[model samples]
Target: MTELTGYQHGLVLGKFYPPHAGHHHLVRTAKERCARLTVLVCAASVESVPLADRVRWMREVHPDVTVVGAVDDVPMDLGDPDIWDAHMAVFRSAVPERVDAVFSSEAYGAELGRRFGAASECVDPGRTAYPVSATAVRKDPVGCWEFLSPPVRAALTRRVVVVGAESTGTTTLARALAEHYRRRGGIWASTGCVPEYGREFSEEKLAELRRARPWAHWSEVTFGTDDFPLIAQRQNELEERAARLGSPVLFCDTDSFATTVWHERYLGGRNPRVEEIADRVDHQLWLLTDHTGVPFEDDGLRDGEELRPWMTDRFRAELTRTGRRFLTMSGPPATRLAAAVEAVDDLLGRGWDFAPPLPERR
Candidate 1:
């Protein structure tokens, strides 16, 4: 083990409402200067983000430090000694060990250190390194998307999935939606569209069969009951990966939820495993591309022209049964795209409704 250096046991405490880049920098600075650092994440009962989530995010970003959480419902009043004492009780209960140093970027660092009988070390008190705060993040996450980590981004990204029968413009609409967002430029320039993994899997299976027996056709490739679960899992994994790296809004050609419907269309029954996998992820909106008036061109892999109406109805039934917010797009290609874009714009207009934090005493 490495020998102790600088302060014996340092401390950093904050609400960590969403754990922004500024908070991360402060913790990293303290960790390098102290042998053992304890980060106390103090959250109130009224905060939107959960205390456990904040603790988990902090631990994920800074694994070297000891991260703990405490419910500090005591009202904030820097001038009141009794309030400070009450808040300190909560902090002390969470961290009873000796604190040689208290690191912070807020004005309360001096008083906090004095009360704990430790040196107060302020890092970037002026927010020069990263001009971001939890308040700013809560108000407009898209404006401050650059400062967020992947886990937070994944949690906040608005996922929009497009599902429909074969060749009904699901892929076309998904790509068009992503392109429309990208045309907005700025932060929206990095908008992503996750292609259907199931399609790729099908293509690979056909290719493999062709190598073994060149006479094998697309219809010859059979799907086992277990294959749907794998498809759903991979589709979810792809969606998550794209969400972590993409813009505020992520578009999916088809998601795990759509996989369940396809499983029923192929195998004639519900697979509990596929349904369970579908329920794991959350999608904000579903655009069901209606098969009416659209011609289904047989792409070798697709053999479900007659099953188009049945599949469309199944999608609508499942979407409604599961209480999912969705819109069925019909008419010409341009009309469908326009309606889809309008729905997405409306979804974005309704800003993330983050519950306000507890009011602080002025």
Candidate 2:
């Protein structure tokens, strides 16, 4: 074993409700000063965030340290010995090994060390490095977006996908929405727009056919039953990547959900595998661009003007059948953009409703 200079085994315990930068800093400090550190994530049943999610976030952020979680329903009371005993029982059950050092930034650190008969080590009790808490994060996640990890950001992001028939301005609207948000500056400047992967796949297929046949037209390129699933899967992957790197709101030209409709349009039936892939990721809103009066530009890869009305109705039907929230956009370009902005603003205004934690015992 390596020579030990500091505490043999250290312990850091907290609710870690959503695991912010402060929690990560504490874990990093504890890990640096001790040979082995165990982070005990105790969550109550009343909390909206699950214990398993908190444990996973901690483990992902700090892979070197040991992370464990336990359902701690016991109400908190610092002065009451009975409540302290009850809470300690839960903590001890999760971490049965001997603890030589107890690290924390809260006022209860000394008492916790005394109860464990270990040295109490405090790091940045002033919260100077990362001035953030679970309560603050829960209240305004957008304001605290920078302090969160990528996984947490991806989970919290509001994904909006624009779906419509050929030449219905879905791409234009998606790009406009992204630009509109990006102009807001600050966190919004990093707003992302995920383009349709299926479109790219189509272009690639056509290009390959042209390379071989040279005289083959876009209509000659064919799609198999298996192709729809791959398109849907790739669309989801692109959306996920953009969500992790972008701001709280992510706009998509089209998504996996739209791929299922395309599958029906081309293959003349439904693909269960494509539907399953679409169901994996959650999208907040779907803006359906109306094909009415919108000129269908063949774009070389498009099917024709006659199919637009059928495709639009199919998308609306499927969206309703699936119970996904959606809005239909029509009229001039400016009018459609204004309506879309209003809907998105309303969605953002609602905010994340994290259930309040159990109150401290009086």
Best by TM-score: 2
Error of 1 at 116 (Å): 2.4
Off by over 4 Å in 2: 1-5
Residue 319 error, candidate 2, Å: 1.3
Candidate 1 lDDT by residue in tens digits, 259-316: 9999999999999999999999989999999999999999889999999999999999
Where's the lowest-lDDT run of ten residues in candidate 1? 1-10
Worst 10 residues of 2 by lDDT: 1-10
At residue 309, what lDDT does model 2 achieve?
92
TM-score of structure candidate 2: 0.95
Q: Report the CA-based lDDT of candidate 1 relative to the real structure.
A: 0.93
**lDDT digits (tens) for residues 1-362 of candidate 2:** 12563888999999997888999999999888899999999999999888998998889889999999999998899999999999999989999989999999999999999999899999899999999998999999999999998878888899999999999999999999999999999999999999999989999999999999998899999999999999999999988889989999999999998999999999899999999999999899999999998887888998768989999999999999999999999998899999999999999999998999989977
